[model samples]
Target: MIGKARGQEGREGAAGVLPAHGMTHYPAAFYHMTHLFYQSGPPLYAGNICTGRSGTAIISLMGETQGRVLLVTSGKELLMEMTPSMSGRGMELVCVPTLKYAADRLAAGDCPTLVVDFGWLPPSERGALLELHKQFPKTQLFTLESVASMAPAVPSPLRRLSWPLPMGFADQVRVIAKPVIILADQVLFSTGAVQNAFQQAGVQAESLEFGAELPDFIRRQSEARAASARTQKPKKGWSLLGGDEEPEQEAAAAIGNLVVAQFTGSAAQAGALDAAVRAVAPEAVCYLVSGVDTQRYAMQSLKEGQPVALPREQAGRIAGIMAESAEGGETRLKQRERERILLLDNFKPALTALSQALIGHGYEVTSSMDGAEALRLTTKGSFHLAVVGTAITMAELSGAELAQKMRERDPDMRIIFMVDQYPLKAALQGVSQVVELGLDDAILKPVEASRLIFSVEKALERRFLLLENARLLKETQEQKNQLELVNGFQKKFFATVAHDVKSPLTAILGYAEVLTGKLKAMPSEGRYAANIQTSAKTLNVLISDLVDLAAMESGKLRVEIGTLNLLAVMNDVYERVKIAATNRKLNMTLEVPPVLPPLAGDDARVGQVVQNLCTNAIQYTKEGGKITIKAELKPDRVEVSVIDTGIGISKEDLPRVWERFFQTKEAMGMRKAGFGLGLKIAREIVQRHGGEMGIESELGVGSRFFFHIPLNGPPPTEGAAGAAPAAAPKPAPPSGLPPAPRPPQQPQPPPQNPHLPPQPPQRK
Candidate 1:
C-alpha cells in the first residue's frame, strides 16, 4: 500500500506504466479511492490521481484549461464526468459530438479549440475530426491515451474521466471555453488510432499533462482569443439565460435597451394600460398582453405586442427602472388618442403653468426646457400634440427647428406654436411652413389658460371625431350586413310559410265547403257551416294576397297586361258587393257608360281593385248609407271611383291608408277583424298595371276612393300616347242617409300577426 497524500484519508495507487518523458499512469483500481490522492512523491508531480469524495479538487484540475472550451466527445460520459466539479468555477465548457460540431461552435465565436477524446470517437465521426484539421490546422485537439508515443508532441499519459457529479453543474458554465484538457482514468486503444488518423490527414497532435504550468498558458490563450474576437465584428445579437429563481438584477440592467411590462389581466385592463402609463408616466412605453379568451373579442386591443410573464417582484423592479428612466431621461412614451402632449420652453414658470393647466384638462403632459432634448425625445417617443414656445431660443436648436424635427419623426403629430410680441412675425412664417407639414394652430403669449385649454380641446375633439367616424363607419357596415342577413332569412321563412301553410289551409276550406253543403237543410247549422266556409275562404284569400305582396316587394310579381272592358270589370265588382250592400241596408249604385273604352290592365287585378273598394264601403257604411261606384272614359285613361257615406279616415290616418295591415281607429272600432291588406293590395295591383289609385276622405263625413288605368292597353313604347291621366273631381253624392258616426281617436299601429310575412310598420 502507498502512503496517504497530504490532507487525504486514502493512499495513492501504484504507477502502472510510463515513458521517459510521460507522467506515471496509475492502476485502474485507484479510480474508486475513498479519499484525495496524488503522486506518492514529487517525481515531476505529473500522474493520474483520484480525489475521494471531494469533487472540488477536480474543479482545480479543470481550471488549468482555457477559459472558453469546446468539449468534443464520442459520448456524454467524459463531459458528464467533468461538469459537476467544474461548475460554479470560471471555466466555460461546451460539449459536442464531433469535430465538425466543434468547428461550428468556433465559427460562432463559441470557443477556439476542441478538447476532444479522440479515442472515444466511433469510426463514422473520425472523418470530421480529420477534415477539421485540414480546415483549421491551428485548432488544438486533445486525446486521452495511456501510451505517450501515440501523440508525439508533448505526449503524456492520460487518465480517463468518468466521475458523476451533482445535477445542474453544467448550467453554471457562464460562457464558451476552448483548448481544454479532458482528464480520464483509463485510455482506450482508439486514442492511438485517432492520433494516427490525424497525422495522416496532415494535422499535428499535441498532448500535455494537467499541472501548475498549464493554467497560466490557458489563461493567456483565452485572453488573446477574447481580444481577437473583440477586434472582429459580431454577426448577431446575444442574450444570456438567467437561473429560474429571482432574475439577476445585474443581468436585467445589462439588457436595458428594452423593458417590457406584460399585464396579465382582463382585456379592458390591458387595453387601458397604454393610457394609464401615459397618465402616470407620460414618458413610459407600455404594451399589454391579456389573458382574455382569443375566441371572443379578438386580442387586438393591446396594440404593441404580447406581454411577458415574470415573477411579480422582478416585474415590479423592471417597472420601477422604466419609470425612473422616463422621469430622468429625455425619452417619453408614444402619444395616443387621449391626447398626450409635450410642452417645451426655456421659460420655466410658463412651462410649469401650461403643463399643469393641460394636466387639469385631462391631458397627458410631458415638458422639457431644452429644445434639443425635446428633439432627441421625439425620436424615441411619440406625441399627439407638441406645444412649442416661439420665445424659446436655445444655442443647440431653436424651438422652430425642434418642432420641425418632431414633425419629421411623425408627420401627423400636431404642433402648436406660442409666440411672444417680438417673434410673432417669425413664428407666423415658421407656422406656415409647418402647416404644410401638419401644424395645427398657434397662440399668442399672455394667453389665458381657458383659451389654451379650448384650443387643445378643439384639436383633440377633431381628432377624436375622425377616429369616432371611422369606428361608426365600421359599425354601420356591420349593421348593414346584419340587415341583409335578416332580409334573406325573412325571404326564406316567407317562402316556407307559403309552401307549408297553403296545403292545410286548402284542406280546411274544402272541409268547410262540404259541411256547408251537407248542413243546408238545417237552417241554424247551415248558417254556422256557411260562416266557417266564409272565414276559410277569407283566410285563403289573405294567404294568397300575402304571397303576392311578398313577390311584389321582392320584384318577383309578374304583370300581364291586355285590353279589358272597363264596364265589365266594374260590373263584376258590383255583383260581389251588392249582397253586402243589401245586408247593411245601404244604397249602392254602379255607374258605367254604355260605350266605355277598354282599359289597359290585368282584368282580374282591376276587378280586385273595384271589389275591395266596394267591400270596404259596405263594411264601414252603416244602415241607410249610400255607396256609389262609377267608371268613366277620359281622353287617355279610364277613372273609377267608389264613393261612400261611411266613417271616413282622419287626416293623420289617411297618409298611411295604402300601407299593408294598416287599419284606422274607426275601422278597428267597428268590431271588424281584417288583415288590413285590401287597400294595400288594391293600390299595388293598380300601380303594377301602370295606373294610379288614391282615397279622399274626411272624418265624420263621406269618402271617395278612385283608381285610373290607361284605356289603349299597355304603352307601346317609352312616352307612348294615352298615358293614364289624373282622375276628374267627383260630383257631390246624392242626398242620402246620415254618414256613419266616427269613433273616438286614439293613435295606434296596425295589428300584427306573426304568421304573416313581416313588413315595415306604418307610422301612425
Candidate 2:
C-alpha cells in the first residue's frame, strides 16, 4: 500500500509506470504539481532539464530545472501503478488538468514544467498558442495522452489560481519565457510575442503569408465562391437586417468591412483592428465577427440584401490623401465652410469631453446615443468622421456597424470603433483593422479634454487630408470652367472696345468737320460740337471702365483699404456726377439724415459704387424726370440709394444688370452708349467691402439701384463721422481715378434706403 504522499490528512496513493526521459508517473487523488514537491523524502524529478535557450528562450527562465516535480493526472489508474514505482523519483502528486490553476504555485520558486491534459477542451476555448503564455508565465508545457476527454471545455475565468506554499521568496528575475512552435506552414513564431494574433487563437492559423484554409465551420458557410474581398454587413436588428423590430441589435459581423479575417477574442485586438483600418484608409468602417452568432447574423444579412456597401474606393482614397497631406500644407484646400464631426456614444462621461475636444480643434461636433441615428445621419452624408465607443447600448446598429454602413455611402468616412472587452475570435473573420479599445492610446472614458482633442485631431488631420485632396481635385476641374469663361470674355471685350472707339471717332471727325465749316459762323453751332465732345467723353469713360474690369479679373486690382467718412464720400460722388444729371435735364435731390457714422474701407471703391449708381440713374432718367440720392444709417450698417423716375429696368434685364458687359436693351438703344462694367464694378467693390449691392426697377416707370456699406471696419472701432459737407470742392481727377479721400468722408447726414419714403418726387 504505497501511501507515502500526504494530503491534508497525510495520505497518498501508490504511483506506477515511469519513463527515463519522459514524465515520472506518480498519482495521487489530491496531487498538486510544483518544481520542489517536498514529500516522500526531500524532492524527486529525473530528466534532462535545461535553462532558457537562445531565440527559443523558455528554458533559461526555469533557473533550476534539475529539481523534483509533483506530478498528477486525474485518472486513478495511472496513479495506482506509479505510486509503487515512484520510490524517490516522484515528489508530490495532485490532479490538475490545466496550468492556470497552478500558476502561482509554479511561480513559487519551484520548477514550472506543467504536463497538462488539455485534450478535454475544444479548440474554441484554446484560442491561440499565446493565450497559455499570457495566462501562465514561466511554465513549460507537456501533454498527456487522452487529455481530450479529461479537461473541461472552457476554463472558468472566475476561479482563483491556488498558491500553496509554506514559506517563499521567488528569485529576482522575472521569467518571460517564450516558446517556439513551428506553424503548419513551417513558419516559426515566438510564443512569447505580444502580437502573434490568430495563431494563438484556436483558429489553426499559420503565418500571415501562409494562411489559405479557413476552419471547417467557416469553409462550410453557404457563401458564394467569390474570391476573397473586403466586405461589411449591417448589425443585427439594424434596418438592413429587415426593418428590425427589436430596438437593440448589435452588428452580426464586425468583419464585414475588412479586407481579411483574423480570429481573435481580445477586445483590445478588435479595437486594434479597427484602428488599423482607419490608419490604412482613415475613413474605412471596420466590422468584427466577435462570435458564431455574430458571424451567422452577418451572413444572413448578406442573404437578405444589404442596404448599402462601401460607396467609394478605400485604397485609392488613402493614396490620394497621402498625396495631399492636409497637415503638412499650411493652406487648407476646402472652401472655408466649417466642418462637423459626430461622436455617437452612449457612455456619456467617457466620451463627451472627447466630442467637445474635437470641436475645439475647429470642427463642429454633434453627438448621438450610438449608431441608432448614425445611419440616418450618414444617409444624409454631411459629417466627416464618426467615432463610436464599444460600451454604447443604443438600439439598432451598433457603433461599429453604423461606421461600416457609413463607409458604403462615403468611402472616405473615417470611423473609430471602441469596445468593452476582448472581442470573440470569430469576430475577426474578414476584418482588416483591429484596435484594442482601452486607455492605452491615451483614450480615456469620460475622456480628458486634452486627450480627447489630441486623438480626434490626429484622426481628422488624416481624414481631412484625404477629403481636402479629393475636394480640391474636383474644384480644380470646376475651375477649368472659369478659365473658359475668362477666355470667352476676352473675345467679347475686344469686340466692344472696337465698336465703342470707332463710334466715338466717327462722331468726333464728323463734328469737327461741321464745326470747321457750317457751324463756324454761329455760336449755336458750338453747342452741336459740344454734343460731339460729350459723346467722345462717354466713349472714353467706357474704354476706361473696361480696362479697370480687365485688371480686376486678372486679380490685379490693387486698391488699398483705409478709413474714410462715408457721408463725405457720398457727397463727393454726388458733386462729381451732379453735372451728368444736369446735362440730361434730370431733376435730382439729395436726402441726408442728421448724424451718420464713419466707415472704414477703400475710399476709391466706395466712391465707385456711389458714382456708378448716380451715373446710372441719370443716364436712364427720361428728360424732365427726377432722380434722388438718399443715405440712411442703421445700427450695423449704412445704406445708400440712387432713385430715378426714368426708363426703369425691365425684370429681364434686372438679374443681368450687374453682369459684366451686360447692357439693358434700352441703354443699348435710347440711352447714350456705355460699357456694361459700371454695375459689375460696383458689385465687385461692394462684395470686397463685405457689403451688398442690388437694384429694383420697372420698365417705363423708374429704377432704384442701391448699395449698403458697413459703417465699421479697419479694426472696427467706434468713431463719430465727419458729417460736415466739403467747404469748397476740389477739382476731381479724371474718370477711373479712385475718388479722393475727404477727411474721413463721413456721411453728410444719415442717408435713406432707396425704398424709403420718397421726399415727394422732384419736378424737372
Candidate 3:
C-alpha cells in the first residue's frame, strides 16, 4: 500500500490524489510471506540514489496502486541483496519460484496487483504468461517486458487485464524489453547463409561467433556453482524471491555491486552493437572477442587500464579503428510552434490544439499549411515531432514520405498523422505504413490532449530507445528450430487454457437450459437457470477470445493481406452489421472516401471488425437517430471510421474496450449476449498486424470509432502448414502468413452488480 500519498508529487512533481475508491487492504500476514530483496544501482526511481552503471525509471508501479507484489527471484539470497530498503515501507514480498508458479498463485484466488520480474523466466518458458491469464481474471498483470515479446499478441481470455512495468522511459518498458525477444531465440550458427546476405548489404549481422564470457571477477566467484550440481530448474519453481526470510544486507550489497550482461554474434554485429551502446553513453568503448585468450586480453586491459586487444587470426585481419557509428548530418532537434495549419478543413480544433500542446510540453512548434511546407521543413529543419494537419495532401511530399524523410534525416524524430476518419480495413493499411516509414506515432483527429500527448511522447521516446536498446540484446544466433518449438509449445498451452475455461461454461449453459426447460414443468428452477446462464455467457466469451488469438497466430484466415478501397470495405461492413442496426432502430449515415485509395490488408478480418463496431454502436444507441461510416483518403493511406449518435462510453471504459473480456459501465450488470471480446478481437486484429485501433467517446452523447491503414501492403500468402484452415475454399497460393479472423474463445459477460439500473434491451 506504499504509493504517492494524497497531495504527493506525481510525474513532473504534480500532486496526485490518494485512493478515492478506498484502496484494497492486504492482510498483515501477506507481508510475512517472503524474504526481501532491494536493488539500487541507477536509482530505480529518482532521488533514491543510484550507483553503478544503469539507467533511470521514474514511475515505479503500474497506474493503479498495486495491492501486493509477487517477486520472481532465484532465492532468498537474491531477495535480500536486491531490496535493501525493505524495512522502510513495511512491504511484504512473496516469492514464487517460476512465472507459472506466480501465475498459478494469482489464479488460485490471490488478488494482489503483481510485479513480475520476467528476467527469471527461462528462455524456454513461452506459454507461462497465457496460462497465468486464464486463471486470474481480476489480477491486472504487468510484464517486466513489453507486450509484443509476449509473443504473437495472442488474445488471452482476460485481454484487457494486462499493463506493463517499464523500468526507464520505456513506453512498453512497463513490460518487456525488445532485446529479450532477440535473446529468447535459441542458438544459431556463426556462418549461417542468412547472415552472409546481410553482410553483403553492408548491414552488420551474424548468426554466431563465440559465446560471450562473464566478467572475469564474477566468473571466479560463480565457479563453485558450476562445480556443484548444475540444476536445470523448472521455470515454474526457480523464484529468486523465495519464502519469507530475513533480509540479507551482504547479499543485497553483492547483487548491487556486480553487473551481469551478455553479448553475442559476430564482429559486425558487435560493431553495430557498439554503435548502439554509444548512442546512450557516447564515451563507452565496446570489445568483441571469442571465448578464447583474446577476450581475456579485453578483460585484463579493462582492469589494468590498458588498450583492448584485436586478435588478427580469429578476427580475419581486424580493422584496427572502430568507434561509435556516425550520427550523420543531423544536429539540432526539430521545432514546430505557433503557425497556421491549412491542410485540414474540418478538424481545425485538432490542429490548433496539437500546436498548443507541443508548445505546452516545452517544444517550439510551427504549423505546415500543406504537404509542400511539411516537405520543406521535414528536410530543412531538425523537427522532433510532426503533426500532419490533414488526412489528404497534395504537393511535393506525401504524408508517408514526409515521415520517411524525417526518419532518414534523424532516425529519431516523432511523426503523427492527424486523421479525420477511416474504415477498419483502411486503418489497418495505414498502420503498416507508419511502421514501414519508421514514423514514431499517429493519432486520429478530434482527440483529447491527454491522448495526444501520450502518442507524442510514446513516438518520440520509442525511436531513441529502440536505437539505444538494440545493442543490449543478448545477440545470440538463435536457432530457428528452437524458437519454433517454444512458440509451438506456447500456442498449444494457450489452446489448453482457453479450452479449460470454456468447459465449465459449456456445462453451465447446458445445465441452465436443462433447468430452464424443467422450470417450465416445476417453475422453481427459473431464477437459478438465469444466474447459471449469465455466468456461462461470461465464460463463453473468454473462450472465444483465446480461440481468436490462436487463429490469428496460426493464420487461418481465408483472405491474404492486400490493398483495397476503404469505401468499398465500408460498404461491405454495412451489409454485415445491418441486422444489428435494424434491431436497435438506428439510422445509418456515410461520409466516405472521395477517390479512395486501396488499403493493404485482409478484407475479411477488417470487415469483421467493422461489423463488431457497428453492432456495438447499434446496441448502445437509444432508439438511435443515426450512425455513420466515414472514409478519408490521406496522401499515402486511408481512414475508415464508424460514427454513431449512441450513448457514449465512459472514460474509464474507453481503454477497456480493446482489452479481452472488458465491458462498459452500463453493460456490467446485464445478461448481455456477447462477451467483452468484440472490441478485444477487433483490436487484436488491428494491432497484431501492426496497426493501431482505439475509440473516442463522450458520455451520453456519442462515440466515434475509427482507425487508419496504409494504401500499400505486402501481398498475402499461405497459412501455416498444419494449422487450422479458414472456412473459405482454398485460394491461390499465398505469399505471407494467412492470419485467421475468428475469435479464439468466446468472451464472458461482465460481472453484474445488483444495485445497478436495469439495461434497456433492443428489439430482436
Best by lDDT: 1
- Choose 1 or 3, whichever is better by TM-score: 1
| lDDT ranking of the models | 1, 2, 3
Q: What is the lDDT of candidate 1?
A: 0.54
Question: Which lDDT tens digits does candidate 1 get at residues 149-260?
Answer: 1221221222111112112212211121222132211111112222232344443333322222333434444455456555544233332343234433333322111121
What range of 10 consecutive residues in model 2 has the weakest lDDT sum? 50-59
* TM-score-sorted candidate list, best first: 1, 2, 3
lDDT of 3 by residue, 467-500 (tens): 4576555343245667888889977976788767
Error of 3 at 483 (Å): 23
**What is the lDDT for 568 in model 3?**
58
Question: Given candidate 1, what's the lDDT at residue 693?
Answer: 81
lDDT against the true structure, per candidate, is 0.54, 0.47, 0.46
| Model 3 ranges with Cα > 4 A deviation | 1-494, 497-544, 552-559, 563-568, 688-690, 714-764
lDDT for model 2, please: 0.47
lDDT of candidate 2 over 1-764, digit per residue (tens): 22232222112221221222222222232332212233567344331111110100011111232233333234434433333233232232333333333343354435444443333433334333235534554443333323222112223111100111001101100111111111111111111111223223322222322222222222222131222222334455457656854422222221221122333333334434444333433333223322122222222222332111111111112212222332332233333345556677776555555554554455556666646566677754487666666555446654455565677877766665554444544234213233432111223244456665666667667877877899999999899999999877885775567556766576676766667466666778777776776666666676667766765675445455675667667778878887878887888888877545656687877887788788777777778889999987654566788888988878787888878778877877765666678888777667556567767789999887777765544222222332221233222211123333434544443433342454553355
